[model samples]
Target: MARGRSLSGPLFLLLGLAAGITVGRRWLDVVEVRGGSMAPFLLPGDRLLVEAHSYESRRPRPGELVLAADPRTPGRELIKRVASIDDAASAAELRGDAPDSSTDSREFGAIPLSAIRWRAVFRYWPPQRAGLLGPGH
Candidate 1:
């Protein structure tokens, strides 16, 4: 009844998987924590699953962890909390959880909306603390 495998079924499945992965990449980003700015909650070397689509889908709010482009450095990324917001400009005043050790809004000023790239939604590393990331501890 069968001398060889049917490739049509397997080919379609592979194609479907590829398409899904491509589309999924657009909504999520994998980032690694590089500093102690977001300490206690997110330490250096911790990996984050960022929700890129959230910034595109909704307005960012206070106390939320957001991935943004460093104002002083081109192409570098920073993760900080929204301590305050400027509704008039639709921008945010970002700060680190450990303010004393952070170079944030106080150093470079509020981050423009365009500089924001994604919202930190989950921590997928260090099995002990793998789950959804809320506003605070």
Candidate 2:
């Protein structure tokens, strides 16, 4: 009876950990800002917690920060803000906080909404600047 109880505890812990990882992968992701495109609001090296499920239920709104697949580079992603959304067309125009430094909608044109995979919800790294990110930030 003692041996069985000990094994059960570890087994349950392992199962719980596996479940957490699966759920995390499906709904949550962390992305690190890589360039000055989103400067002032999100600088390079800022780590953001992004959620994928939100967009599944509702369309993205203007001014929201999002992680999208770079149209110019396959397999690469870029972080930008939603400048406008066209529900009828299923596309969104994205832009950088610093327009002069960003290669966004201006260069590649509005991207398909399907290309946008995650919405940034919080800045968790660079402790001093960490906080919940919103449309205004």
The candidate that wins on lDDT is 2
lDDT of 2 at 88: 90
**CA lDDT for candidate 2:** 0.82
Q: Which predicted model would earn the best TM-score?
A: 2
- Which regions of candidate 1 deviate over 4 angstroms? 1-22
Per residue, candidate 2 scores C-alpha lDDT tens digits across 1-137 of 11235546545634543565478777876678898988898999998778888999888999899999899899999999999998899999999999999999999999999888799987767867766688955
Give all TM-scores, in the order shown.
0.81, 0.82
Worst 10-residue lDDT window for candidate 2 reads: 1-10
How accurate locally, in lDDT, is each candidate? 0.78, 0.82
Instruction: Residues 14-51, candidate 1: write the lDDT tens digits.
Output: 45435644778776666789989778778998877777
- Backbone atom clashes (below 3 Å) for every candidate: 0, 0
Which parts of model 2 are misplaced by more than 4 Å?
1-22
Residue 3, model 1: lDDT of 15
The TM-score between candidate 1 and the true structure equals 0.81
